[model samples]
Target: MTLAKAAAEVRERAWVPYSRFKVGAAIRAASGKVYAGCNVENVAYPEGTCAEAGAIAAMCAGGDYKIAEVYVIADSPEPVPCCGGCRQKIAEFAGPDVRVTMATTDGKEKTVTVAELLPGVFSAAHMDRA
Candidate 1:
């Protein structure tokens, strides 16, 4: 299924009780497999899981570490962007040019690359001893 559809479907299962703001994410792994996730909120405020992070976790659990494309959907006035931490997490598994599509439930969408999402992203190369 398409990333958009996958994300939209999973969004319905979000465990959001505090803000009632549900979000969903889907990733197309380099293995050509699609993984989907939904945001899970908790009463602890910041302890909740983000949709993008959950999708990445699912991808890793499925044995695919590389992300080719990503889609995120939410109910909002405009396409919702990933949080700063999710952007960094995505940059870790996706190349600079990987496409990230953010969309609103009403059909509005905005596309950007991994590089655009997190410029000067910190990577393993930065820790190389060479």
Candidate 2:
């Protein structure tokens, strides 16, 4: 499925009973494989993971670490882009110019790159390799 369709499908199946705020995310890996995920919220919010996180986990579990594109969906009037944490995660795999598509419940979509979404983002490149 396309990024938009995958994210939409994931959103339709998000598990956010507590927050009643569902979210969906889809990412295209360097392998040209598309992965989709839905928010799985727990009663203990801290235990919950974002849709992007889930997608990354799924891809990693399948031996994919490179991301090419990403799409997010949320039922809100305003643009529901990926969170700061999610942005960092995406940066680990997605390129600085990787495309990120965010869509709101109102059908409005915002497209940008990782740099546009998270300027001056931190990454492993800053760390010392032992």
Q: How well does candidate 2 match the true structure in TM-score terms?
A: 0.93
- How many pairs of residues collide in each model? 0, 0
Q: Write the per-residue lDDT of candidate 2 for residues 1-130, one digit (tens) a residue.
A: 7988888888899988899999999999999888999999888758999999999998898889999999998999887878889999999888899999999867899999999999998877679687
Per-candidate TM-scores read 0.98, 0.93
Candidate 2 residue pairs in clash (backbone atoms < 3 Å): none
In candidate 1, residue 81 scores what lDDT?
A: 94
lDDT for each candidate structure: 0.98, 0.90
- On TM-score, the leading prediction is 1
**lDDT per residue (tens digit) for residues 1-130 in model 1:** 9999999999999999899999999999999999999999989889999999999999999999999999999999999999999999999999999999999999999999999999999999999996
Q: For candidate 1, what is the lDDT?
A: 0.98
